[model samples]
Target: MFDIKSFFKREVEKKLIDVDDYIFMPERVEMELEGGLLNCVLNSDGRVDIFYSKEGVTEVSSASRKHPFTSFETELNHGVYDDVIDDLIKEVSKIIDGSSKYFRRNKVLPSTAALPSKPPTDL
Candidate 1:
């Protein structure tokens, strides 16, 4: 007497366990996507911190300070895994397409010093 439904459920659970293991790895996983770099770090509360930088920066501190693109936190489980992944892709695409409001640029202020009346001619 083989229970087909139970068998399939067990198989799916096994696959999910493997994915969970990878997500829980001590080292962060990184990849390049749409002219930017994406980083995933596992947090202690079973959530992942995802960061995107358009400058191709891998360091989180540098990216946050210089070119902060987009960042979010997500908890992935078997039930909502697909939905979460799809939403992540869409968000990243928005950032690359320059349509996301999260995109930011560092502003440089012009100097306020007065200019000289005559130009110095020193050859």
Candidate 2:
């Protein structure tokens, strides 16, 4: 018997771990770019949202569902569910890669804020 709830839980956890690898910060991972700021978050609903902020406002946003596995029928095939999760992982990987690259190119360090300048030597 296929345990849909257990399968979903396992797949979601796996995907979250994969996503966390790209996120160097807590819930909100952010980067600064010439265009603006890029932010991503793993939502409670098992969806990931990417936002682009310019001039202190979000200009663009995109979302992807973590559970790509599932069927309309009450009963689902185990193999099919596995395949869906695989696909979901691949799609999320691309998003993570893209976000990481953007941060790298922009020279933004996640989970870090610029520190104050050193005081004068004379002080």
Candidate 3:
């Protein structure tokens, strides 16, 4: 199992405004942190998001037809999902070693608030 709690700490609320700069993966997408639901914005790579929400996380208010890839896959494995919200998120999610459970049981890719620059090399 992945330490989702810490994962959130490291990525979800890292104060990273322009996540695109931190991650340079081809599929990484930018992210927007909201109440609970991490909405995935449409991009050339993919239009979806991957996240683990707290119990009271936000929900999708507007009704829709197809469940985005994130929603669909999330239904299967609650731990992780994928969407193309921005360039950064898309890129981060693709890396197998990006995180502890990157592609296995706990692989996930979520965005967070922007932070001051600390040099990509530092990260």
Which structure among the candidates has the greatest TM-score?
Answer: 1
Of models 2 and 3, which has the larger TM-score?
Answer: 2
Candidate 2 collision pairs: none
TM-score of each: 0.34, 0.29, 0.15
Per-prediction count of colliding residue pairs?
0, 0, 28
Q: Tell how far residue 84 is off in model 3, in angstroms.
A: 13
lDDT per residue as tens, model 2, 1-123: 999999999997887656334422224556564455655554545355565555444433435433333321211223323344344444544564455435465585568786769866886
Model 1 alpha-carbon drift over 4 Å, by segment: 1-25, 56-111, 114-123
Q: Which stretches of candidate 2 lie over 4 Å from their true place?
A: 1-26, 65-123
Q: Report lDDT (Cα) of residue 44, candidate 3.
A: 34
Score residue 65 of candidate 1 by CA lDDT.
12
lDDT of each: 0.48, 0.48, 0.38
lDDT of candidate 1 over 1-123, digit per residue (tens)? 999999999997776654334323333656765666666665533455556666433323211111111122232222223344345566656655564355446645568989989898894
Query: How close is each model in CA RMSD to the real structure?
Result: 13.6, 17.1, 25.1
Order of quality (lDDT): 1, 2, 3
